[model samples]
Target: MTAGAGGRPGAAGRFASAVFGIAVLVFVLAPLLWLALRAFAGSWTYPHLLPSQWSLRWWSQVWDTPGLTSSIRLSLIITPIVTVLAMIVCLPAAYAIARYRFPGRQLVLMTIFATNAFPRFGLFITMASLFYSLNLMDRMAGVVIVQLIGTIVFMTWIPAAAFAAIPPSLEEAARDAGAGALRTFFTVTLPLAAPSILVAVILSFLAAFDEAQGTFLVGSPDIVTMPVQMYSLIGNYPDQVAAVFSIMLSIPSVLLLSLVRRRVLGGTIAQGFTIR
Candidate 1:
């Protein structure tokens, strides 16, 4: 049979797929390109396809901005704390959901998924008054707590899936070798699930670091995160400075993902499914 008549997609199909992929790439990258341009552009009036001049003034402004430094520091402190706390709270719960056939298991899972599915703004609005009453408003702890609601839901589901992918037989083997449940988990199950756990940690950090609405609603003025600072700057300052701040805000997450890309991509969630 000819190549066109073979089971493979025809040239037209390949062409269509390529065109679609290129279109998607452009759609996603266009805004980022514009932001980058605006961040450095000195002047670009209407009808100009590109900037008439370019300068480092906005980049300098980003460093000079007083709130920017504080916001970055707060994000740095909060993101890691949120990631660790979410992992600590979610790990056992995830393991239980993965390993045990408990009452209300489906209900628990559904509740988590539902919480994640809900509109964050609505939740923030509803909780704002409650937070103030509790004296949690404008506190870093409150922002962390608010961010945790979504992160925990996400962190639980991912690790649960990862743990489920691990075979019980491995735990059995570790036990047969005289390892207790906790020891076996730390020794075998945890090592095997580390990659996925790392993914959860990374995602949790990003969620907390980039959290804007909740931070703005509950922690603004007292505890400004990078995203909240970006929003505030965009509202009050020039767009170019805001773009520079946007770039600054994105750098950490990009660096983090780049750092962990090797481990995440090298190890599979189902790595523990195999005997050896």
Candidate 2:
């Protein structure tokens, strides 16, 4: 009787979990599947759930589109640049937050978290005017610098938390043995914190890559990106644009996230905040 009750509850829990998973999948997959079908069908009607006919006319045109290649190149260039800069800048910033005791630390962290709370688009005109004065307008370098300002907090904070989770005494031990700060960082801190950094880099790349408002806010027609191109394509050719660019825009991130997601989920960030 005891064994049967345990088995019954386990079976019920499994059924409920399965139902919830299927519901979530349907919600996400249904629209994407519809988009995939319609993109191949070369149709523009959206009120209908699915298109009746299917064709490859729109898919072929994706290659011939004039500005498509440029936008792709620009995005490919900018995403990695911002990710690299964010990672490099974040190392010291993370170290400070993790290891140091300073005035205004909580206030600074609060301010950084607050930036992600609000929509960054509200600052478009102000950011544009600021970048304009700095001569970043229409330049790839400018976009990178501008993106750097916004992404720094996310890039650093989580990694800092990861670094902090390591007992500080480890570093002290390394130092007592005569390792310098930089050497300790590379040999001890970095190896331990590497997976966190990888997660941060992937997150930063996706954040900058998908930024419609920031990209459009400071971006020009001269420097096109994938989302910018997709936006323009929506205005002109809504049919095929979703198909080709979906793969282009999605693959890098999907591959990266798949690799790093295990680390991210298993990370110290998963345990929530603890400042020491």
Best by lDDT: 1
lDDT of each: 0.83, 0.75
Clashes of 1: 0
TM-score of each: 0.89, 0.85
Compared with the true structure, the alpha-carbon lDDT of candidate 1 equals: 0.83
In each prediction, how many residue pairs overlap at the backbone (N, C-alpha, C within less than 3 A)?
Answer: 0, 0
lDDT of 1 at 146: 90
Compose the digit string of candidate 1's lDDT tens values, residues 1-276: 233456788888788778988999999999999998999899988899899999889888888878888888888889888888898898899899889998999888887778767899999998889998999998978998998886886588777878887999999999999999999999999998877887778877888888899989999778988898877787699889888888888897888889678755765424422222
Off by over 4 Å in 2: 1-16, 42-54, 267-276
